[model samples]
Target: MNVRGVIAGLLFLPITILLSIAVCLARPFSRLAWPSKVMQLWANSVFWMSGIKLQVVGEEHLTAGKPAIYMANHASMIDIPILVAVLPGHVRFLFKHTLMYVPFLGQAMMLLGMIPINRTNRTKSVESLRKAGERIRSGIDVIIFPEGTRTKTGEMLPFKNGGFLMAIQEGFDIVPVTIHNSREVCGRNSIVTRKGVCRVTIHPRYETTGFTVADRRQIMSDVERIIGSAVQLRGRDNAAPVIELGHH
Candidate 1:
């Protein structure tokens, strides 16, 4: 890991936490509106400070006032911020169970109603998915990195079935999100940074209306194929409008 990268990350941690707190406190009254704007502010700041540029495409596929499961490929630390900043609606995150215990950040996450699932334990994982499915039924959009962890190489990893299983069981639509070049910019295993362009392609959504638990593997494979093809098509397309993040 780069010493400068570590120091830079540490310097930004407090500001990020403060932003999280502010969003949490304002969430009750503003609901998704204020919180979503604040989140974009923080995300944009992180990317700008890191000297990364964002190009997000296919946002028109996202239907306003509708809930869908956004299953994105995980490759770098910046992927979360890119998605949070670019996605049109208010989206909740599915975090690891252990993250729920992290200091003030954890409390703020709870206030935001982020879902945490224990992947190592079957019973707990199922229960967590059930809760998440209920939230989807209630019209809350949730973002899940189906890969479960980041890929060392930029290539997509085999996705875990948990998120697909939940989407199928709840009959929610699955949005296949492909993130291109983020791993090259800031890899998950290393904090070392590079100034480069990263793109997020939101592919057409897959409906799970008639899917069952038995179709989990198939559903996962279909989404993977869609994202993989899209990722391969990434380029410096000046035609696609870049999502601009305002200074915090």
Candidate 2:
């Protein structure tokens, strides 16, 4: 077992509890602002504890005080904190409903008013995205993992249509974010995490102003390609990456 990974994993539970409490306390001060600010701290803490370095490109594309749909290719649980750490504005996630049972994490999600998508049910999932779209129009940035679940391999998964449909319905610009090397740091079903750098490439926003439902497939294909552009083609690994990657 990787010693750093084992130790880091052990600390996660306490770290989560402390951060979750902070989120709950911050909620009373300013609904979204305080909570979001605390989450940024939480994300950074996760990075620190895991010894994971972050490199962000196209951060200029993330406008402050703007509401848009941020679509990203998901690979690992680390991707959650990665999005929270890098993306600007008050951002919330379109997450699985099952996360609602993850102890302190679940309560914090509820406090943040994060949208939970019921993946087992098609209509309910659409309804969840609809609710997320409403949140966007009301001036909140939402991050959606179009892949729906973490990929076991380093390859991109087929993009799901729910988030794209919501983007068209809401008429928000889609920021296609590409996350690199997270799977190596923390793979699916793994409890330990290794030290590594996870580079995030935030491409220029894809506007959905004139796009209709019919255009979603093309849009999904395009966004998926953009995100996959920077991903390294290789078999998946569960430990920290050994080879050097990403420019500083």
Candidate 3:
């Protein structure tokens, strides 16, 4: 474990939590403007303290004032903060239900109107997505990591159908987002953070207007392929060639 990183994270956690509470209290119930700005600050602070360098690409693909579901690949716990730092405009996450009980952080997240999915219960999951759809219709953008959990091996995981199907059912477009080398910074199930550049690539949005519920599998595959290929390309590009120096 990176003791210094753990210490840094511990020192910053409460500050961000307090900032979150203060911002939420000021905004009151998901007012995107002030809250989004606060989140941006918080994300930036966390990344700075953790020494995580973020390199964002393809942000031009995102259109202003267009509500879309951002489907991203998950590899690290820090992915949320990285997205918060890089993604433009207002955005909320489709997070797991258990995170809703996390003390002050939970209250802040609720105030931000983050949707929680109960994967174990079909009924609740559907209801959650229904609410998410309503939010998207209301012009709030939502981000979902369809991988459902962080990848342990830094390779793409098979995506769950829930998020993609929800986008299709609600007629929301899907933005395929590829987050490269996140695991090198902070891997799944580990809190030790390393200093490195985390690359975020935002692909053009995929419209779901023509897709039916039956197309969920294909939709998932397409998104996975896009993200996986981008990640692989980035890995290859980042791989350093070994050079040997002869004695002079």
Clashing pairs in 1: none
What is the TM-score ranking, best to worst?
Answer: 2, 3, 1
Pairs that collide in candidate 2 are none
Candidate 3: global Cα-lDDT?
0.78
RMSD of candidate 3 to the true fold?
A: 6.5
Q: Which is the winner by TM-score between candidate 1 and candidate 2?
A: 2
> How close is each model in CA RMSD to the real structure?
2.9, 4.6, 6.5
- Is 1 or 2 the stronger prediction by lDDT? 2
> Would you estimate the TM-scores of all the predictions?
0.87, 0.88, 0.88
lDDT of 2 at 31: 72
lDDT of 1 by residue, 140-168 (tens): 78899887778876788888899888887
What are the runs in model 2 whose C-alpha is more than 4 Å off? 1-4, 233-248
Taking all chains together, the TM-score of candidate 2 against the true structure is 0.88
lDDT score for residue 209 of model 2: 91
Candidate 1's TM-score: 0.87
**Tens-digit lDDT string for candidate 2 (112-157):** 6788999889889978988898888877899999888888776778
